[model samples]
Structures are given as C-alpha cells and as structure tokens.
Target: MVQNPETIQECIEKARQRLYQIANQYPDLWHPEVIRQSMVLDELINEYNQATRLKKTIKI
Candidate 1:
C-alpha cells in the first residue's frame, strides 16, 4: 500500500496525540500497546519519506 506524504504526516500526528493521551491517562504504567503503535507510526512515516525520495530520484 502507498500513502502520500501529507496523509502519512497526518497519521503520525494523530498517533502522537493518542500517545500523549495515553500517557496522561496512565501516568504510572507504560503501556506496551501504545508504544508499539507509536513505533509503527514512526516506521510508516519513515517508509513514506523514503518512498517519496526514491520517486524524486527516479524523476531526476
């Protein structure tokens, strides 16, 4: 699946917001699920950026 940069950015931002909310709700414990989701979001953002760069390089 392919995602545009803007969409990827939006998703990343949403994930970050959710992470913050989770942290606020559970100040004592670290939730593995939330952390994992954030990590996945980061990976997706990185992948999107790399794909965009590759596309630009190919066009050059």
Candidate 2:
C-alpha cells in the first residue's frame, strides 16, 4: 500500500498522475489499476472533508 499523503488534494492529484502514466504505459492493465486508485482517492477525499468539517464544528 502507498503511504498516506499529507493533504487530500495532493493525494488525489498524485494518484491521477499515476493513473495517467499507467494508462499510457499499459493500456491493458490500466482498467483495474485506475479503478483501484480512483477508489482510494475518493476515500481520502471523503475522510479529509469529514475531518475538516468536524474541526469546524468543534471550533464553533
């Protein structure tokens, strides 16, 4: 597994760049790999959003 990114946006951008590279280098294997990366990115974004929202609520 890859290490967790410091920020959600950065993680998603890096994953997308990797997905693009994989799609270009290995077209046949791109399908499964892209799906996996996309899922992970989605989860990271969701978790980040939730954490930020919780922090805001606590501050108020």
Candidate 3:
C-alpha cells in the first residue's frame, strides 16, 4: 500500500514530540526508555525519507 507523505510527516512530528517529552522526564540521555523513544523517532524519519525518495524516483 502507498503511504501519504503528509501522514508520514504527522507521524514524524508526533514521534519527535514524544521523544522530547520523554527526554525531559529522563535527564539521562542513555536511559533505556529515552533511547527507545529516540529509536522510534529515528525509524519514522527513515521511513519518511524513504517515502519521499520513492515519490521522486517514480516515473508517471
């Protein structure tokens, strides 16, 4: 299934906000929970990048 770029952007924003909230609660950057949230954000970013790249590469 094709994913909407806008939807992916929204997910990225939500994940980024969640990561920031988690970081604020846990000052330790390496805390497991914080690290987990960071990873989640990273994955969203990667997905967004891939989706956008696919849009650019596809020929009509």
Candidate topping lDDT: 3
> 43, model 2: CA deviation in Å?
0.4
Ranking by lDDT: 3, 1, 2
- Model 1 TM-score, all chains together: 0.67
CA RMSD of each candidate after superposition? 2.1, 4.5, 1.4
Tens-digit lDDT track of model 3 for 1-60: 557789989998999999899999999999999999999989888888888888988944
Model 3 alpha-carbon miss at residue 13, Å: 0.5
| Counted clashes in each candidate structure | 0, 0, 0
TM-score of each: 0.67, 0.62, 0.90
lDDT, residue 40, model 2? 76
Q: Which stretches of candidate 1 lie over 4 Å from their true place?
A: none
lDDT of 1 by residue, 1-60 (tens): 767777787878887787777777767445786677668778977877887887788889
lDDT of each: 0.76, 0.70, 0.89
Clashing pairs in 2: none
- Residues forming the 10-long window of minimal summed lDDT in candidate 3: 51-60
